[model samples]
Target: MPKIEEAQPKYLQIAHHIRDQILRGDLRPGDEVPSERQLASSWKVSRPTAARSLEALSHQGLVEKRQGSGTYVRSLEVNRRARELYGRAKQTGKIYTPGEYAVITSAGWLEAPDYVAEALGLAVGARAVHRRRVTNNDSGPITLSTSWFGPEVGERAPKLRDPDRIREGTLMYVESVTGRQGSYAEDRMCARSSTDDEAADLDLAPGAAVLIVHHVVYDLQDRPLEFAEATYPPERWAFEQGYPIV
Candidate 1:
């Protein structure tokens, strides 16, 4: 075989080399890649050139650079892929990916905020079951989720008021109690800076941008069942949905 001529930029070439290592399992997620100085020494390149290579990978979201710490491969892509297959995972009552866990940090009746009330079609100041949860893996927090259920549904499903992982998950429990299936969901997506509480919960720096998804779920009768807001660190999660054209 003739030696392949490489035409890509030096930094890109280095990025590709490191990327291959990750793909081949040589450098697993959360594993640190060579430091810029190490790369510069090994590749006989300037430190800036090595830095560019790592920066390129970071931009691709394949790795993350921690302040005062070196770059480490990101678990985001793998986690996202697993989540993408959640429709299949749901059948087994296993909603999360391997090594991941979700906890209901708090659950109780709370006065609905304007936004939550509007989403769930409840009156302002109405009491609603509010459930707060955080999902995480060894890589740290993945998402912080808060769900509100209208009194009609909330009171019916007493389990929703408890602070624990719903063993059968919430949707199934809703179907069981209401004798109705979730017929549709409306989602609104936006990007916003982390709130102080959100920053602390997610281990993100203040003002770091996060992806927010607000969900309104309805039953077959077209009655709103729940309103939920899920906040994700941009690098750790991506949202995807598909539907057939009517």
Candidate 2:
């Protein structure tokens, strides 16, 4: 069989490989990562590409470089429990995990932001249904999630416009109402300073570091059904998953 190729740049592939090791606990905190030359030799890539891989990890706050010392794993806080939470929600009609609850801060029809509009294939500044919520555990707020849908979805699923929690979970509720099952989802993530609104919702000081995930769920037709932005306060949440190597 022909070998399947990765679409990501070689540097990113290297970075992701290292990241997986970290998340899998194969590389614990303070453990030294392979040197750039070693990575180049192992991955059969240029030294520049290997160095870029480490740089990418540093930007994600996954590793740190020391003077005269090689890079080291800086954190092992990444957990796969977040995925479990969603999976349980889908199966049990519960939106949150044990010891977690959410407050619906706002829910109504509003003009979608340009990015959200684009994700939902709507014109710029088009009106959409917006639902904002903050999930909290005993430790305090963990995530601030804002979900957007086209106006038509809101009209069909009127409960989406209410502040009450959807006992069936939003995704399931949408599927029930619209007959549009979520076929797949895409996530784009970045680390950046929290906005004032996000900081307030997540109970962090303004300008604090945050991990933002832009998530879009698509129907069988590959049309986006919902666009959500989930913001996590620094040091509070991380995502980890393992997959088979080809």
Superposed on all Cα atoms, the candidates' RMSDs to the truth, in angstroms, are 11.6, 8.8
Which candidate ranks first by lDDT, i.e. highest? 2
lDDT of each: 0.75, 0.80
TM-score of 1: 0.65
Which pairs clash (backbone N, Cα, C closer than 3 Å) in model 1?
none
lDDT string, candidate 2, 6-58, tens digits: 66577877887787666544566889999999988888888998899899889
Each prediction's TM-score against the native? 0.65, 0.67
Give the runs in model 1 whose Cα sits over 4 Å from its true position. Answer: 1-89, 237-246
